[model samples]
Each structure stands twice: as structure tokens, then as C-alpha cells.
Target: MNVDPAVPLACEPANQNAGTALQDPEQGALSADEYALFASVARVRRVYAGETLFHRGDLGTTMYVIAKGAIELDFGEDLIAKSLGPCEFFGELGLLIGDHARSADARAIDDGELLELRHEEFQRLVEIDPTLVSYFLRRAIMRVVFNEQSLIRRLRRRNQDLQSALDSLRATTQQLSRTEALVRRDELTGLYNRRGLLQHLRERHRNGATSGLGLLLIDCDQFKRINDEHGHLIGDRVLQGVANILRSVAGTNDIACRLGGDEFCLLVKAETREEVMRYAEFVIHTSHGLLQMPQLPPLICPMSIGACLVCAEGEWNDWYARADTALYRAKRQGGNRVEWQDNAPIPA
Candidate 1:
């Protein structure tokens, strides 16, 4: 095609006209000199608004130059789509690239004329102008540099986003752990409360590892009398004092709970009869401070304990009832003592 250098390089309403600035190297419209040199190989085509010119994954045999209106090239993989206006040429990479596959989808945003250049045509044009090889080489190097920089930016952003998500997840997990601990503990005595007691007992029983596990149910004998005589404040201090004593005497593997009111429970790991008796005696001996009435005058802190061995064959409630029965016997036979479900009694 003989393009007259004097004629303006512009597209007509229906199609592109030959002889334009696209072939003029002096014009800055083409980013590279190679585009102006090889663009002469292209033929004109007409496109309308909302018309699809090309798609990603299609065999890219030809490149397009927009002489009029606008065209959008959407990289199918990313939201970073680009819009090209007049005097801009696209798919010019056909001259330097060999894979010949479209990298993005190209659609017309408005009615316009385009110049389509095929790879074969570009090769023939290169033979006509031997310097075309040098221009194409320069453009290829520039494309490589631009693409590498773009990929690096995307990777850095992705890494930052991943780190942010992990940090949020870690914070959420820690908060849940704190909330769970608070829910299972008593606010007043800092011991496991009733809800904590039930959950622990149920889990222990379900595990079928109740061998050597023993239960000690404790109650503050004549507690109501102390609260009535010394006010609830003194009564609460007495309860906390008893809890401290039990906590101190209990083994590291054992669990202690306050079952509301003046009732408490201790689950111990004493394997033999002697071990169990030792725990019971130690609790009674150390709790003498509670029995002393600082303000109420000798009528305070007296407690009764019911002991029973935990059995895997029995349910949590059954073990509790047996221990409770032992407690009932200790209370019935006068308080301030321990009664074993096996009929053994601990000296107060």
C-alpha cells in the first residue's frame, strides 16, 4: 500500500483510510519507532459500539490500531483493563511476538475504524525495511522490562493482603480463648463455677479415664446462721477462705469447683484407700481457721464433706448422688466431719 505522507493518518466513519501519520516516524503517536515503520502492513476494518474485536485465548494472528473512537482491552485475568483512544495502536506485539495468542479481550466502546496487521504481513514488511529488525528488538526489550515490573508490583500487593488476613485471624482466636476462660470461671472466688463443674465432670466421665478419680462434696455447715448473724459480707469471706484452703491442699492433677452458695466440689486423683483418707484428713485439719469465729464467736466456718470413688461404669450424676449421700450422713451425724460412701469416717 502506497501511503502519501502529506495525507492525514485518520480513520473514516466506515473504515480506515490509507496514508496517515501512523507511518510517519516523526509523529509521537506511536510509542516506538517500530510501530510507525511496520504499521504500514495493516489493512483497515470497521467496528461499532459495544462490538467485540478479540478475546483472550484466541489465536492472535493480527494487531489493531485505533484511528478513531475508543477501544477497551480487558486483561481477562485481572480488573486492570485499559482504554485506548485515537492515534493509539494495540496488538502491535504481533510483529515481535511468536506465541500468537491473545493476552486480553478487545472490544469497541464506540463506533470506529481500525487498522488490522497480521504477523505474516508484519514479517514481509520487515524484509522491505531491514532496520525494522533493530526497532523490533528495542521494543521487545522494553516490553520485557515493563512486564517484569508489573508482575513484581502484583506479587507484593498479594503478600501484603495475605499477611493482613492472618493477623486478623490470630487476634480473633486469642479473644475467643480469653472469653472462653472467663465463661468457665467464677467471678468471686476465681475458682471454676457451677457451669465449669458440669462441663469438666461430663468431659472426664466421657473420656473413660475415671480410674483412681474420687469426688469430695463439701458444704458449709450452718452457713445460713453465719450469714444471718455476721451479715453476707463476712459469710462471703469465710467461703473464700475455705476455698483457698481446699485449693492449697488439692493435688496438682485435681480439679476444684464452687457449686454456688456455700457448696463446693473437689475431684481428686487418689488411687488407694490410704491416699484418699490422707486427702480427706488434710482438708479437715487445715480448715480449722475457718471453724474459728473471729467476729461471730466460735459459731463459724464449720463444714461437712462427703467422699465417693469415681467409677467409669457410673454416670456423673450417679457419682454426685453417692457423694451427696455421704455428705447427708456427715451432716446428719452432726457437721464438721467427713463421711466416706464406703462407710469409713474421717476423724474431725
Candidate 2:
């Protein structure tokens, strides 16, 4: 199992300076007496070129001694490889440490003959020639030390790679969090957008508490006239003023959203139809007061709100449709008013 320590033992091109670090290269081959002793009890195994004897991490129970041709031991990525020629032995760890896992892949570099030695065969050989067995055992211990040093080097390299991977993951996570925040909000009003409303609806539905909720669909009456008479800037100011009013009245469990353009909606927690009607009236009154403030541009844009209590058996489309119907009715009666729908539509 032990080879001269000075030589770089690895699987590389044949042109590379590699082999046992013995002072005399001939010493790498077994002596006639050593070969005779092993050949007596060893089983001959023939392997063709490119044949795989075992893979890294496989449980190894037998050792192989090369008799002719060559074998290559490949220690995967960032480690040295070893190529064994005639008379050199490998896989002694399987015999030394019972049930040992192979640290490298063993494959045939050429059509070769190897002497396979199992634990029992090795034990019987030890009893017949104790002196020779002790000599090999001493070498085996040195081989284990050499392999331990190699493992320490491999672990150090792995630790560096792990830290780099962790840093990249943290950066990616931060970017995703920022993107999610931007996606769920309106840039102008800083209110939850349509996408955010859908997300909130999904969460509420998941909790199975769809009842006792109210939806108010508010629209800016004659919004196009406001933009044309004054300026688009003044029109924007009116929408912002309305958004501020909705934000002030919303409870902790409520969501206020800009459903695009001059349309906004509020989803609030309410116990009865009266409570929902009161909330809509509060929004309409507050919105009028805020827009008429002396500091703001002098423009009149009345808000018409359609209010309804959400039904447990219906979805958002059903809830919005009923609110929308009530909204049109309010606009028809008067520009600045709130209309409540006592009953929500039944799903078909």
C-alpha cells in the first residue's frame, strides 16, 4: 500500500513524471520472492482496457495487486490521481479497515491481470509468513498517514467553496425581496395596487374567513372634465387627496387599493350592512373636505361609491359586480353620494 513519498502519485498523462518515489524505479516492481508469496494464494482477475473495477464511495472488501498491464486510481476533482503498473498493489485499505469505503475510482488503464486478495486469504497468508506480513503492515500504516494529509487538503478547499456559495445566495435573496415590494404597490399613491389586492384576497380565502367583509368601489365622477378644465396635474392632486382620505379611515385589518386610473377600492372588515354604509359615507365626506382645502388646487371632483357586504359563497368578481351596479346608481342619483347594495349576487 505504501509507495515512495517523493513521487507525485496521480492519474495524469503518461508523459508526466509520475510513479513510486523509490530511489531505483525498478524497486517499484515486486521482488521474485514477494511475487511468489502473493501469487500462491491470490485469485487472478482479468480486466479489459476501460473497465471499471469499483467507484469512489463503494464499499471495498478486496485488495488488488497488479500482475501485468496497468490500473488507474482516479481521486475526483482537485485531488491527485494514481496509475499503478506491474507488481504495485492498491486497495489495501479494504483489508486493513473492515467495510471501508473506497476514496477513489479504480479502472483499468490497459487490459490487465490483478491478484485479488480477500480478508480471509490475507489472514491465512499472514499466519504462513508472519515476517513478510509485518513488513507490508508497516507500509500500510504509512499509506494511511499520507492519505489523511490529502483529505485535510481537500476539506480546506471545500470550505472556501461553501462560503462563496453562501454569499451569492444572500445577494440573490435581497434582490428578490426588493422586487416583490415594488411589484405590490402603486408608484403614485403609494397604495396597494390591483396585484396586491389579489394577493390579500388569496390570503383571506386561505384563512376561510370570507364573510363579514365589505367592498367599496369608488369612482371619480366626471374625471375627464377635471383633467380638461384644470390641468392633468390638478386632476392627479384630486386622486391623491381621495387616497389620503381612504388611508385615514382604513382599520388595521383593512386594505385600500388603487384599481388603476381614477378608480379606487377599499376592502374593510364589517359586521353588518349598516356598518358598510357608514364607512362609504365617511369616505365621501372626508374626500370632499380634503379636496376643498385652501392649500390644494381649487378643483371639484366628486367621488361616487358603490358599497356591498361580501358573501362567503362568492368570489371577487361577484363582489365587484354588485358594488359596481350600486356605484352607477349613485352617480345617476347625484355625483357626490354613496349607494349600498343590501344583497350580493348568488354565484351561478
Candidate 3:
């Protein structure tokens, strides 16, 4: 088949002739006359079923107008595909813009006859009928604009979804941190528990800063007798009062911890054994004075304290054993007193 160079390429009403029409969902269909006009000026090519007409990104210099059978246009990457039947046209961009790259892969699903208008023929048609060619260009450009807008909207929605996921992750992280803090705290005293004390020591040891520190182990003398006479509610209040006293005497670098029932310890920064002794004395004196206050509950028990300097050459177990021995000595000497363990090598 051959097309006359003088024939105009313009759309007509779909009902004008009994010939096949070019279908476009957005702009409606073109009349059989218009389809014939394009075919008349173009070269005819036969394509077999399952034949590829063109591929995406292939530089194209010709446009195809279908006369028989079905063709499919596949634009990958989440874009919707298009199916075209008889009288539909595709690849217009190739003829309009010289050497234009195809945007989609076009394949024939059935044996078909297509009207292929090369760049030379398109140029001659434009010269013969500029007004009709301009109208055709406007319609094709509109379709391209619509597709671009649809892609932009999809990208925007995806970005918002990603942001929401990130926010949810951050909230979950913060909640986990708060839960960890509660796990390491004493309920009655709002102070570090035994677990927290170990964690603090581990951190300091990791930084190699555990040397020149003091550990003061304290025990409430006759605590069981006091609890037996007073209710457990009063016992809890007494513990809270002892915690407050420890808090008041502790320095900025000190850590006050409750190591379970009737036992507490203070980890303080002390350069000499004398400093450790002074801390133990201060705790014993303040605790005795506080128990005798008129508004507070009357109690006969006193705090027995043992002081030991944390040796650079020793482990935490060694330091704890020596301090515990000193604590027993203070209790044996009848409580309300401070005892110190001289820095010495472990017996084992």
C-alpha cells in the first residue's frame, strides 16, 4: 500500500463512513475517512502475531496506524498498559519529533496490517496541511501531560507513607528506652536498684575510670524487730526516709542504690580512705538524727556502715567481700558506727 503525499491528516466524525475508526478514550474516535486519509499517505506493513513493533527507549523515526488485528502498548514500572484494536494509532511522537525514543514497547497480538508513516512522509504531510497537523499534535501532547501528572501523584503518596513509617519507628524506640529505665529503678525509693548499680559499675569499668572510688555498704540494725512491731506500710516509709538521707549526703559523682531489703550502698568518688570513712560517718550520724524527729515514726534501729576503697588491682567481688566483712564487724560492735577495711590483697 502507498499513501499520497498531498492528502491531509485530520480527524472526522466517527459516524461519517462505514470504514474503521481510530479510537481514543479521552478525545473520542476519529472517522473512517480520517483513518483512511492517514493510511492513504503511508506505506503498509504486515506484522505476524506476537511480533514486536517497537521497544521502549528505541530511537524511532516512524509512526504506526493499525488497519487490522490487535496491538498492545506496555509501559513498564507500575504504569498501566494499553490495548489497541483496529484503526488506533501509536508512535506519533516518532514522526512528530525526529529520532524520538519510544516511551513504551508495542507488540502485535494478532496478524495485522499497519500504516507506517516515516519522517519524510510526515514532513511532507505537515507542509501540505499545517493546520490539521497542529491539531493532531495538540491532542497527543495533552495525553502526555495527563500521564506525567498521574505519575507525580503516585510518587507523592509513596513519600507520605514512608514518612509515617519512620515516625512510628521513632515512637517505638523512645518507649523502649523508658521501659528500660523503669526496670533498673527501685519502686519505693526512686533510686537505683541492684541491677542499676551493676550497670553503673560496668560502664565505669568499660571506660577504665573505676579506680580511686569508695563503696559504703549500709545495713539497718534490728530491722526485722522494727518491722514486726510496726506494719509493713511503716517499714516502707522508713526505707524511703533512709533513701532521702543518702540522697542528701551523696556528692554529684555519687550513686545511691538499694540492694534489696534493709540493705543499701553508696558508690562515691574518694581519693583516700579517710574520705570514705567520713562518708560512712556522715550517713550514720544523719540517719540517727532523722529517726528521732518529732513528726517522724519512732524507731530504735540505726544504720551500721562499712567503708572500703575500690582498689585498681581488684575485681568487684573482692571489693564487695571486704566491705561485707567490715559491715559485720560494725554490727558486732553494736551498730550506729562506721567501720573501714584496710586496702589489702584478697585472701584467695
Q: Which candidate number has the best TM-score?
A: 3
Superposition TM-score, candidate 3 onto the true structure: 0.54
Please list the residue runs of candidate 3 whose C-alpha ends up more than 4 Å from where it truly belongs after superposition.
1-157, 299-301, 346-348
Alpha-carbon RMSD of each model: 27.2, 24.5, 28.2
What shift in Å separates residue 321 of candidate 3 from its native position after superposition? Answer: 0.6
Q: How many Å off is the CA of 218 in candidate 2?
A: 0.5
Clashing pairs in 2: 10-81, 10-82, 11-81, 11-82
- The alpha-carbon lDDT assigned to residue 124 of candidate 3 equals 66
- Please provide, for model 3 over 1-348, each residue's C-alpha lDDT reduced to its tens digit, 9 standing for 90 to 100: 384443234433334542332234233233455566566578878889999988887988788877767788897788788887666678765565457667689999999777788877776665665534544555554554444456557667545533443354455445545655665789899889987888788778888988889999999987777678777777887788788888988888899999999899998999898899888888888877866776445433589988899987677788888899889899999988888888775465
Candidate 2 C-alpha lDDT tens digits along 1-348: 322232223322232333343333222344445556677777778889999999988988898877777898898977778888876777876676556678789999998688888988787766776545554554554555456545766677554533443354445445545555566788788889998898789888999978899999999988888788788989888788778888989999999999999999999999798889888989888767765676435444679999999988888998999998889899899768998887735344
Best by lDDT: 2
**Per-prediction backbone clash count:** 1, 4, 2
How many pairs of residues collide in model 1?
Answer: 1
Better of 2 and 3 by lDDT: 2
Q: Which model, 1 or 2, shows the larger lDDT?
A: 2
What's the true lDDT of residue 226 in model 3? 69
lDDT, residue 74, model 2: 97
Clashing pairs in 3: 3-40, 3-41
CA lDDT of each prediction against the hidden true structure: 0.67, 0.75, 0.73
